[model samples]
Target: MKFNVLNLIFAIVLITNCDIAFSQKLAVIQIEDLYLTSPPIENKKTSISYLVEPSDNIVIQYYTCILNDEFSTCKSDDLLSSGETEDYSISVSIPKDLAGKYLSYCISAISKSGAYLPSENECRSELITNGDIDNKNALFSYLNQTKNFSLYNAPITDAKDDVSFVTSNSAALSLSSEGDASLIGYGSEVTNAPNLPKAKEVYSMLDGFAIKSESDDAIIWGQFDTTPSYINQVEEIFPAPYAMAAILKDGGINTAGDMVRGGSISSEAQKRIDKLLSKDGLPKAIYHTAQAFLAVFDMPSGKQKLVAWGQSIYGGTLPDEMKSALSIKDIVTSQDSFTVLDNDGNAYSWGHSPFEQHQNIQTVYATRYAFAGITTSGKVKAWGDSYYGGLLSSAAIDFTNTNPITRLCASDASFVAISDGNKGVAAWGNDYGAGYIPSNIQTELDATTITDDFHCASTEKAIALYDSSHLFVWGDKKYGGALPSNIPTFSIANVIGNNHAFLMKAMDDVYAWGGLNQGGCIPDGHQCLSSDDSSLNLRSAINDLSDISQIGSFNTFSEFEEEVVGGFYVRGSGAVVMWGNSVPDGVFNE
Candidate 1:
């Protein structure tokens, strides 16, 4: 390496004499106490920390050159401000790429007046090879200390290194609540995302997660193509069982993942399509179901327009009245028909025996094969396949003056309505589904003394009830209608259900029941039950249930709506915990 000593000397004299013209005193700027904070390491940033006098307006100029590369020259292109110090010391990061090479570095301070700080040029001159291993036997000495635990019964030994555990191939690492670390059996190598910020919000789609950062960046992991979409700030995401769409901050619409034929796309094409929607207007909201996707946009003409895609039951054509409606109040769907309620109290239905004419509709509910509407006067009307709750039975209509129906919910094949006064609940639709309230639950409902705060959820064949104090479930036992026999008592705070399973967050823990590989199972390390039937207490595995802010299923269901694939638990800290099947069975996005 060559140095322009004569030039530096000339520049220093000029700055020194110029400073005397103003301050009438020569500046005593100098770099002091320079040293490497740690030994240089391969493939890792090496820090050099130092303390300096009179830190203001000082710039740190650092130069490095590989020791044996005769063609290499030292360069000081990067300058760090002296004001950016920590704990009375400033640090400089040495590039991690200098592995297996001896390196020489020089650090000096320069004042704003262009005067160089006097320091020992011989300091940090010794040649040291960046931490590079030449022998396989020495690799263990560089490994991070790990606990003697492995998920696959492989032997584990504690190593002495203090760095993060490194994996060369497909090895997976799992950390326990106790901080015990284990390596899962190797499969494929995982690469970390470059410069990803901390996650702020996350949402789950059919088989992956959409993560939003505090910086407003949105990224996806699991089941997405490798190419990045480079999304703008995401405002909201609407995820359906089979497909998903999102609205950007600029009101541009982006859609991805899961198609009618079970395909998916990355955000690339979605960005191109965003131009099409941008010409119309910004989307106020987007909605999706297993069969189709829809968006409502505020047009430039001061009117709202609706767009639909995929195999919609309406066959890409909306009703004339719906197209001209001033504004849509709500839109809902059953298995074969889609319903829309307009702001003017008119309701429209199309596909699979659409209801003729409905007016003054306050609310609407649906089972797979039926639709029920409650008019402003509180009268309930039903239509579609009578056997699947298209028509209410006489018993279901018997609302007394004291016990009036308050709310309605549905399983895949049935409708359930709960009354206000005595907590009475009535059901109609397929018998084996939630259509018939069990006699035991009916007795409990009739005997209920409290009249408020009842929450309910349902799967394909069962309904779960959380009455302020107790949880009651009824329907088909095989599909999570009944609580698992070994589960602890329920003071359930919340409950979520996909088609085949139910997940409940209770006072002490979270629990699930149904098909083991579906939403019923938590991830391996967090399982509530051990192979020996000992209680692991899932909340302990998760640290605490209260940290979780929301829970939901991917909502993947079988063709007959008999099984759920997986679910997600979103923590208040913006970390999402996903369980069940993560990979789609077929080539969904290919």
Candidate 2:
């Protein structure tokens, strides 16, 4: 039915029906992304946003139940005002008692006579409650959304007065319903800011000695100071000096010492790196420690150009003779050695390697003094300073010739791998005081993702994202395995092991299961932990944080301190939270 707004104003509007009725109708194409400005609460002015439709009479309404459910109250009739803009918004006085809950909305170009528009995804996210999420990255994957965010309150860093729940899928952010902007409050200004990269390509990293690569929102993580000098005398190939990661552990090997920013690699060397990484080789990142510096494939072209700081300024800078030599699928650099995985399913070692074989390798990792590899067929391989680890040739199993290993992880003294197609886990190394895969690790892999590292004393802690979608750890009864058993089992979205463990849950919360002491690892008294000190229990480290969108590890071994392993997470609110080391810093809690 068709009726103009002019006639509708003369009569009162009700929830079920309207006064006018006509034969013609207006169709609502579709409502794009919904940007919620008001914190999901009642009794305050709230805003909902969407783009404009061709129809002159666009009505936006909300219902008590689902928008699909009939007989719901009209939140506002005049909320669809987006003057001079393609985007539009509706602002209405919110009723009290709707805090921390989802609100459904409906928008339509219905006849003035009152009709609903049937659209795809009709009740889908027409409204999203800005409440905390319990599972940021669940296995069944609720949102299946991998987001990276950074929060900013112009006048203040933590301005929550006029909050907006924004996501990467947003079309445009609106500050208020003041204009045709579909956004409300401070968020509109945020989207309109200059140089904002659209979705997908939004994340970036910048690091280099004197020279660095960056985008508009690039965040400079870690710390290194250096002068921008290169080659025999100085070549400012990189604009910034020591601007990024990869500072050599032994700076004395370079002629310019720590002052040297970066060096050049042979064009031919670049080609080898490209072919080796093949489809997986995106862009080689800088890698180094206090004693080594490597800018793999360092050139404008993704060709031959890899340079390392060794053997005098550019030690391992490949010569033309070795240009087509080796294609590396992946690279892992320990404090003094490097393990390169070849595309042909083989492993290669240089500087220091305990074993010379790399047959059918799938993935590789290096501990402070040892190396480990997983074969495509699902088997484990090991080498290097075995120390207390049975990884030595004398071990009973044939690690070198083993095959069918699904996954592999390493620590300073031990090696762990998944076998039986992830049906079980096996560990070989020192496990006296640290975590060792309890005999059930094989059964543990049934529905889980492994995240392990050389925890305390090569603790060999086993951390996994379980089938139930919760984070669980075991191994050395002294490190992660010793976590309290009473920790909640809601959802453990992401985890990283750094001699200790850091677990990220939904709703901007982070937990840690680490401490040098024998007492509880939780800084605050734990609420849900078992009394048994031998059980693996995680303690809440930080809570009520911004929603988490992404998780990653951040480790630096040189200058910072001894074996300081940490991690970083991106919150839906766009804040970066870092945890590691006991040192004090404004960017992260030590």
Candidate 3:
């Protein structure tokens, strides 16, 4: 039999497969270049081609590997028949996580008997460059894949070689050149050339020569000569030449010889300066100037001082201390009537002073109608009608011609007197029922002072002890004798009498009995009164009030009178309140 080499080769492959009953033909698979639909050329779907032999029943498989780990294995079954050679292609999805260089799979045919043929491999074409190449000349060969060449180990040359030189030293040129070169150098050569106009050169030379001449003139005048020209030249060179002269003068430079030796003004000129300094205003100016100069030069002066002139009336540095001192003596109310001391040390009264009860005055007595004052020398003076019976009468049985009476008091028709030796209370004037001095009070007792109210009929019922807090009552029980069952045991602070009796407790709260309309018992809240109850309506008129510190009344019948034409007077902290018959307008001046 005549045999073609290609047919003989195919027959030998068939004969080697005959022992297995069915020939398992071998095929070669190749993935030369991978194409992808997505950007980053490596990321597109990959299709593979394979060469299949005749009589081969082949299956193709596809797989992707990640981080050198196998991920997906897929197969296309029965792709080739026995003894036939063919090309087959398959596509695979590129996994998004598959990056950098990877060994992508292109697997060959598997025999019909379920045996896989070996797969062919290719060198890893990079999916991504991994930044191992020079960036400036990195070719973006496929718009996505980068072709990086090894650059650092490459030989350096001035010209391009067989291997393309990405970077060349030929692009650089020297910046220096030999003689008479119009092209000075490479790079920024145009900026470095020396260029000057002829006019500028001439002007520069003239300016330099002028400066040197001026400098020489300054040196010659300042060191060699003493003429006015030289002085003016020095002044021109050094501004404020007086300051320079001062320095020179301080250095003891005087004559022309001294000036030639760079010295200062003479001793005679300095003496004139001293004389000027001794002058009044001149010294002050000089001192100020010196201080200013020292300050400007940052120099210190041991005796630097500031002088001021003025009288230190309130002390040089501290303030003065001078204040006024004053005090209060006695407060006289506007309602108090006027009374004068007579030549015989007796008290003479006048006016409608309801506080004293209308009466003419003679000697001090214990009668209720009368109020009297006894002199410190023991002389007695009396005034007003006698209220406590004949206690003020010169004919009383117990009454002695004592030279001096210490004190005396009077209630309704009653009077009480106190001498250094004896103490007694008496009653006289208009009696309201039992308004008389008690006989029980005639006991021998020493009294330092005595007081009574002629206006209160209730006052005639009781006599208050001098130092003791006890009260002695000997008359009718109808008036203030009806003490409340809960009367507090208190020391009597005071007893004020009007139509009623006002008992002031030690706590200053006042209690009253007998009458309320006569302004007798000034209630806690009521203050002043206007008219007497003697006219039409029998009601007492009271006006604006705040607090009452004291009150006084005269006759009981007068206090209880149906018509009070004249009313009570009251005093308060800021002003007085009056509402009686004779109330004046704006009495407070407020």
Top model by lDDT, which number? 1
Instruction: Please list the residue runs of candidate 2 whose C-alpha ends up more than 4 Å from where it truly belongs after superposition.
Output: 1-257, 260-290, 294-307, 311-324, 353-357, 360-362, 376-378, 388-403, 420-422, 432-435, 439-472, 476-479, 506-509, 516-543, 550-590
- Could you tell which candidate, 1 or 2, scores higher by TM-score? 1
Residue 9 accuracy (lDDT) in model 3: 25
Candidates in order: C-alpha RMSD to true structure = 26.3, 21.0, 61.0
Consecutive 10-residue window with the lowest summed lDDT within model 3 = 201-210
Q: Which regions of candidate 1 fall more than 4 Å away from where they truly are? A: 1-200, 212-235, 248-250, 258-281, 299-303, 314-316, 351-357, 385-387, 400-403, 484-490, 516-564, 567-590
Candidate 2: worst-modelled 10 consecutive residues by lDDT: 137-146
Arranged by lDDT with the best first, the candidates are: 1, 2, 3
Per-residue lDDT of 306-351 in model 1, one digit per residue for the tens? 6556553522234455554245556666555566655445567765
State TM-scores per candidate.
0.55, 0.44, 0.26
Per-residue lDDT, model 3, residue 395, is 28
Q: Which candidate, 1 or 2, would have the higher lDDT against the true structure?
A: 1
lDDT for every model? 0.50, 0.35, 0.27
- Tell me how many clashing residue pairs each candidate has: 1, 62, 60
Q: In candidate 3, residue 51 scores what lDDT? A: 45
